[model samples]
Target chain A: MIIAMASGKGGTGKTTLSVNLAKAFSQPVQLLDCDVEEPNDHLFLGGELLNETIVSVLVPEVDASRCDGCRACSAFCRYNAIIVPGKTALVFPELCHSCGGCIKVCPQNALKEVEQRIGLIRTWRSGGISLLQGQLDVGVASAPPLIRVLKERIEPDRIVILDAPPGTSCPVVTTLRGADLALLVTEPTPFGLHDLTIAVEMVREINLPMAVIVNRMGIGDDRVQRFCQAENIPVIAEIMDDRRIAENYSRGLAAIDHVPGFRAVMIELRDKITALCRKEA
Target chain B: MKIAFSTSGSNLDAPLDSRFGRCASFLIYDLETDQFEIISNLQNLTAAQGAGIQAAETVVRSGAQALITGHCGPKAFKVLSAAGVTVYNAAEGTVHAALNAYKAGQLPPTSSADVEGHWS
Candidate 1:
């Protein structure tokens, strides 16, 4: 079963919950960091780099010699990546969405598609858990493509835990689309509640069974709990506000390592998640 | 020489839209013919990304030598400047007023983008 841990607000402990939960399982598990823009799960896991793959997107390249000043490719390109002025077609790879419409519509056959490196996918193993992460190149606007590429590599036999990027945008949507359950990690602050509401709506739209985990439980009021109760969403667990957990996190250590009793908390959380998945099955 | 102004309405009396990429319409005026035409910018307004670059390409395709808009982004400015199109700042007023200002050379030509990308 695939479980996606997501949070609408950044710094809400999606990675923390995902990493610790993956480590809690005695059986081999798969941990996928779908936050391609900045994959930090490797920092907490501290595993050896097993394999790496570079991902590329096809962008249009124009040959001005064979082209007339017809502007056909420019007119056909929805992204406006191609600009045809007089006798040349200027291609902006950054703006290209890799749709290849410009090359198909070129009347003179002057356009050709070229591969442009967009991101990387790396796999690592530390103990029974195998970690896969997608790392998008800097200045690349799109992450959904890389996330899709990474999700395709998920092993079906093992239990998969996905660490989704923050927000209800395209990347998050792509990460949680096919998951068996969504584990929304949130805080008790107003910003947390506001964004959690958005995240819940997104999960509902995607038609996934989900529950909530309120991180930093003591930092704010009980409004998040009240809201969750009113919405009939289950609060699976709450990680109390502890300075030791924060210190361990800052030092790239999981709560299970430095904070006492945290291991049991994560183990119980993992069992609850397993039960939820079984209920769905 | 021909000039283009980002306008909210079809006629010369429309207000000058501050947004370049998401402008409702564009007014293209020819100095030799003394005639103007309004083209609706529906596609770029609804574009999720690259709207500025798309709008710039449309203006360049219209054969306009000068553009009068409230702001221009770096990417759009590069596209326009590469096509030898001079950019001018559109003052706060109707499209007709902006046209008159351009006629009187009151609008200054910009060497760089006045606003960052995706300003709207």
Candidate 2:
């Protein structure tokens, strides 16, 4: 079962809930951190790295040795990534979307594909969980390519848990698009409610089965619970804002480790998710 | 004679307005008869992601002779350039006004100093 954990706004406890629940699972699992931009699940899990590989995207590179000044390659290019002068061509790598049409239509074999490193995908193994984390190189604006790399690394059949990026944006949707079930981890606050609404709208648009896990539940009002109940979005679990728990968390301890009793709650959460997936079928 | 207009959206029903990156449509105008007619935007492969690259690609793929948009990232400008699409910088306003300005050749097709980030 591929379970995805997502939150609309950042820092709404998506990682916190994901790490704890993943740790609680007794069965072998693989945790995927799809938040390529800012991955923090590793900080919580402290897993040992197994392997890491740089992921790059192919961009067209124009060779200057060609004879003719004809601009067929440039003419065929729809993305303006190449500018062919009389005897040569200039290529802006970032603009090239790797659509080989430029090469296919080029009169001269001046255009060649070159790789540009965009990000890295690392695999880690912990107690019982195998972690897949994608880290985008700083200054790289794109995340889709990296996301593809991470998702492609999914194991054959395992209880995969994906820690998705925040917001209802492109990266979030791309990561959660194929999720069996998305766990919307949230806090009970006005900001949380507002963003949760957006998240809900996005998930509903995609028609995914989802439930909410409220962290720091007692700190806020019942508005969150009320909204979830009204929308028929089940509030799967509630985590109180316990000072001891927070302190333990700061030391890189999982909530389940500090409070072993919460494992049962996660078990129930897992059961509820499995039931939802079964219903989906 | 075809010209693609840079848009924030990928279609006619595409909402076009914003800080260019988030703009709705990249109105592709055909320069047939020395006038402009818009062609379709590039397919929105990223209905899941924002209309950033898809809109830019629409402007690039429409294969229009010229592109009209409010603003553009250097990355997009490069893509459009490679696609043989001449980009014109226009201000955000009614679509008709922008189109007319393009017909009169009043829009600036050259990138401003601010537009050129690393290269002067």
Candidate 3:
């Protein structure tokens, strides 16, 4: 079973929930952090680096020595990444999608593909859980491709937990595509409810089974609870507003480790998720 | 000289599109012949990213010697500048007004990109 943790707005506790879930599972769980922009699961679950792999995207490289600049490559590139100006082709790797249309249409054969490093995927093991996270290089615009590379490493047999990025953009959709269940974490405030509505709609649009996890449960109003009830979505769990829990989180310690009896809560959440998945199956 | 202006309509009287990358259309005006043509920029107008760069390349490919638009991002500015295409700030009102402003030397050539990336 694959479970994805997501939040429409940042700082809503997606990472906190994901880390605790991985810890609660007695079976070997594969936790893949798809939030390449800011992966923080490693901080919560400290472990020795088992392996590291460089992730690169194929970007076009122009061979200036070629005889002619027919402008074919430039015209064919929908991205406008290849520019043939004054008898030479200039390639902007950042804009390239690696579609290879420019290379295929180039009559002069002036374009070649080259690997450009965009991010790194590292693997770690802590206790019974195996962690994989993608760290995208700063300034890289294309993250879906790197997220795809990270998803490819998912072990199907084990219970895989994915920590998805915030928002309802392409990256979030990419992470949610094949998820068995999506656990949306949100606060109890008006801003949380507003974004949660969009997030719920996004998940429903993609036709995925999802449940809500209201973090900082008592800080804001009960509007999120009412909205969830009206929408007929289940509230799987709630992490109460506790100052000590926040302090523990800031120190890179999981709630299971710091707060008394929090491990029991996480274990209960794990069982609930497993039961739900079993019911679906 | 051939010049391009980002526009909201197909004709010279069309309103000037404030966005350079995600404009509705581009009006390529030929100063010598006193004629102009319009090309739909619909493809890049909804681009997920790099709309500015794509639009700049489109103007450059149209064989325009200069461009007039409301804003140009850093990447697009570099591409147009390297291709020797002069870029000027967009004029108020219609495309024709911008052309007149260009002819009267009322429009100043931009020394650098007026806006950052993803302005639109």
Candidate 4:
């Protein structure tokens, strides 16, 4: 079964829960960190490097010799990536969506697709878990393509856990696609509840089964729990606000190994996720 | 010579629109014929992105030799420069006044974009 861990707000413990849960699972697990912008799961794993793969996206390259400045390519591009000013076409690779519509529409056949390096996917092994994470190149505006490439490395036989990026944008949706369940990690504050509501709506729009895991459960009011109860969404697990867990996290230590009672919490959470996945299946 | 002025209204009497990319309209005036026409920029005004590049394409395709606006962005400036179209910084007044200033050679030609891209 594939479980995607996501959060509407940043620093809400998506990474924390994902690493701990992966460590708690008894069988071998495949953890994919789909947060290409800033992947930090490797910091906690401290594993040996397995392999690296370069991820690239196709962008348009204009041929100045065969171009007659017909403006057809520019007219067909929705992103305005290609423009014909005078007698040749100019391509802004960063703006190109890699749709290849401009090449199809080019009457002069001046546009060609070329690969541009967008990011890197690195695989590592820590104990029974194999972690693959994508790190997007700086200044790249898009992250979904890299995340898609990372998700393709998911091992079908092993239990997979996807650590998705924050928010309900395209990147998160890309990670959540084709997952058995979406495990939304959030806090108990009003801010968490507000963004969590938006995230729930997004998940519902995609028709995905979802459950909530409330982290830092001691400080804020029970509004998040109440909201989940009202919405018929299950609050599967709650990790209390503990300074020791925070300290272990700061030291790049997995809560399952360092914290005293965190192992039981992760075990229970893993069992609940397994049950939910079974029900979903 | 034909010159384009980014304007808030359709006529030459209207004030110059400071924003070049998302301007309301463009007033194209011919120096020799003393005739002018207004091109609505509504399509680019509501564009999600690349408004500056598209707006520059509009000016270049109009066969205008010069563009008069309050500020230009890097992309738009690059397009205009590639098309050999001179960009003149317009004064804070009506299109008619900017036209007079251009005719008098009072408005200076910009070497580069004064404002960054996506400046609203």
Candidate 5:
């Protein structure tokens, strides 16, 4: 089963639950950290890197001498990011979509496409799990490109768990979409509850079935549980605020490795996911 | 030359208009006949989550010089670059709009992928 572990906010143990769940599954599993901006799954698993690939973007460089005063390029652009004066055309590097429609329009053959490196993809294998991660170059701001690279390395045979980035925006949606089941990881504080609602709504809007896993369960009030019960969304697994687990987490260890019950809970979680997938199928 | 518009569904049925805020779906157009042929998406393999790379490889394999799409991230942009396909950004409107824009020579020739997670 393909499961996406996502939360609305950061620092909600989304990665912790996702990696642990992958290890707990009785069968072979693959864990992918789709949070390209700050992937921590590898930090937790600490496996050897198998392969590295550079992901690139398409950009246009106009040959001024060949460029005619034709406005075909501008007319094709939906972003309104380019400016072509009577004699010359200028492109805003940031807004270009790399569609190559402009090149087709140029009668003079003035535009030559070029590539710019965006990020790196690393594939690694843990004991029973193969990890794929996208690490955006230090200065790059976009996760979409890196996320694309990581997704390319997915293997379907094993149970795949995606550690999705927080929020319900395009990146998170891109990472979480098409999963067999989505496990929404949230905490118990008021802040966690508020963001959880947003994430839940986003998933429902996508028409994907999802459940909730409240990490650090006991510290916050019972409001999260109340909300879940009211919505009829099952609380799959609850992890309390344990000092030992927290310490292990800070040192990049999966909670199941340090906690006694997390491994068993993950096994149960795996069963729940499989049952859900069968029902949907 | 035969042109293939990179598309997300094999049969042009799975990807509909408006649900994903997309226009006539992602496609490749034949400049010779001015006809649009939607390239089938290989991302359905279950292993590949996003087919940007696969799509680019497919486009490269097709030998299409110029391509069009609404939005593409940086990684796919690189694959297309290796294949020598020029790219344009922000063309999500109707296919007619894209063609007209191309005819008018208003669209920029190409763009690099960098749509999400800007970090200074």
Candidate 6:
């Protein structure tokens, strides 16, 4: 079963929950950090770097020499990545979605697919858990392509946990696609409730089963709990507000190993997720 | 010579739009004919991305020899420059005033993009 840990607001403890849950699983698990912009799961799970693979996306390369100024490529591109104002086509690599529609629409065969480096995927092994994370190159406007590539590496047999990026944007959507369950992590504040409402809507739009995890439970009011109750979504787990957990997190230590009684919480959370997945299946 | 002025409305009396990419419309004024036409930029105005590039393409395709806008981004500036369209920074006034400034050679030709991409 694939479980994606997502939060609408940043710094809401998605990474913390994901790392601890992965470590708590008795069987081998695959943790994929789909937060390509700033993947920090590897910091908590200190393991040997097995290998790194360069991730690239196919973008259009226009051969200006053989091109007529037909503007067919530009007309077909929804992204407006290519344009033919005069006698030659100008291609904007950053704006290209790599749909290859421009190349297909080119009457003169002036466009061809070319690989553009977006980021790198690194694999690490820590005990029974295998962690894979994507690191996007700076100045890259898009992150969904790299997240899609990372999700493709999911091993079918082992339990997979996807550490999604914050927000309900394209990157988060890409990470949550095809997951068995979505673990919406949030705190108990108004900001958390507001974004969580939007996040719930996004998840519902995709027709995915979701559960809420309330982190730092003591800091904010019970509005998040009330909202979730009204929305009929289950509050599967709540990690209490503890300074020791924060200190351990800052020192790059997994809560399952460093924080006392955290292991039991993770184990219970893992069991609940497994039961929910079974019920869903 | 034909020049395109990014405007908030479809006439010379309309205020000049500071944003070239997401402008409401372009008022194309012909120097020789003393005629002008309006081209709506509604499509590019709501574009998810690359609005400047598409807007530049629109200006080039309109056969305009020059563009007058308050601020031009890097991508749009590059496109206009490559198409040999002289870009002039528009003063804070109506399109008619900007056109008069251009005819009087009071508007300075911009050597490069006045603002970064996605300025508006």
Encode model 4's per-residue lDDT on A77-178: one tens digit a residue.
878788988999888787887898998988888888899999999999999999999999998989998998898888877899999999999999999989
Which has the greatest DockQ?
6
> Model 1: per-residue lDDT, tens digit, A1-281?
99999998999999988898898999999999999998999999989999999999899887778888688887787777888754688888988888888888888899898899999999999999899989999999899889999999898778999999999999999999989999999999999999999999999999999999999988989999999999999999999988898898899998887789999999999889999999997
Q: For model 5 chain A, where is the 10-residue window of minimal lDDT?
A: A79-88
lDDT of 6 by residue, A9-117 (tens): 9999999999999999889999999999999999999999999999999998878888988999989888888887678888889998988898888889988899999
In model 6, the number of clashes is: 0
lDDT at A138, model 1: 95
Docking quality level of the chain pair in candidate 6: medium
What are the per-model DockQ values?
0.47, 0.08, 0.35, 0.74, 0.02, 0.75
Ordered by DockQ, highest first, the candidates read 6, 4, 1, 3, 2, 5
| lDDT (Cα atoms) of all candidates against the true structure | 0.90, 0.73, 0.89, 0.92, 0.71, 0.93
**Between the candidate structures 4 and 5, which one is better when assessed by lDDT?**
4
Q: lDDT by residue for model 5 over B25-95, one digit each (tens)?
A: 34666678765566444332332122344455556556677665656555456656655677655344555
TM-score for the A-chain in each candidate structure: 0.96, 0.90, 0.96, 0.98, 0.92, 0.98
DockQ of 4: 0.74
Local error of candidate 2 at residue A187 (angstroms):
1.8
DockQ of candidate 2, scored on C-alphas against the true complex (2 decimals): 0.08
TM-scores of the models, in the order given: 0.89, 0.69, 0.85, 0.95, 0.67, 0.97
lDDT of 3 by residue, A10-127 (tens): 8898898899889988899999999999888999998878999999999888888983878888778777787764567778888888898888888778778889999999999999
Q: Model 4, range B2-115, lDDT digits (tens) per residue?
A: 999999899878999999999998999999999999988889978878898999999998999999999999989989999999999876899999999998989989999999
Could you give the fnat of all candidates in order? 0.38, 0.03, 0.24, 0.59, 0.00, 0.66
Tell how far residue A242 is off in model 1, in angstroms: 1.9
- Model 1 misplaced stretches (Cα beyond 4 Å): A69-72, B9-16, B90-112
Give the TM-score ranking, best first: 6, 4, 1, 3, 2, 5
Which has the higher TM-score value, candidate number 2 or candidate number 6? 6
Q: What value does the TM-score of chain B take for model 5?
A: 0.66
